[model samples]
Target: GCLPISIIGLLVETTHLSLVTPVGWWLLVYSTVVQFCIAYVSWFAALARLPASVAAIGTMAVPVIGVVASAIALGEPLGAGQIAALVFTLAAVVLATR
Candidate 1:
């Protein structure tokens, strides 16, 4: 909770930050709030109940999930960097699960 607030404050404090357009700031805030609710809080709860290795595999799904979501939500083309991230995430999951 406090960590998330701290992270948001860091994001807001960055001079490099700027909205892509008029509504971008609103969307940024909304998405950040939603992600904090869904992923961050839920993950913390899940880790408490599950083995750390199991929890880690579940958490590592994020990059792959993001790859698919970006395709759907943003119509973004998959690039080499993303592909690499996905591969690394997959390898990590496999190693951790094994």
Candidate 2:
């Protein structure tokens, strides 16, 4: 709610554009908005039901997944630092979960 409004407000202020999305970009933006809403709702429900420690540990994979997904989907290079960070993150999650 507030997140989308704040983002829209910022876009409006910076670009001085109307509340209209471009014709071709509307579907793409709509899809992204749907995905964000779904993820936000699911995350809220998960946090409500789960322990904070467990939720925090679960989110540790978010960055690792983001890096890997970007590399695969965007042809981005996976640097050694990213690989190391991912390994360390996985190790920490494994250890914490145990």
Clashing pairs in 1: none
List residue ranges in candidate 1 displaced over 4 A: 1-28, 79-88
Q: For each candidate, give its TM-score against the true structure.
A: 0.56, 0.61
lDDT of 1 by residue, 9-55 (tens): 89888655553775887788788898768878888988899988888
Model 1: lDDT to the true structure: 0.82
lDDT of 2 by residue, 1-98 (tens): 78999998887776534655697477767688988898889888889999877887758889888989999999999989889989999998998887
Output the lDDT of residue 2, model 2: 88
Per-model C-alpha RMSD: 5.8, 4.6
Q: Indicate the TM-score of model 2.
A: 0.61
Model 1: how far residue 56 lies from native, Å: 0.8
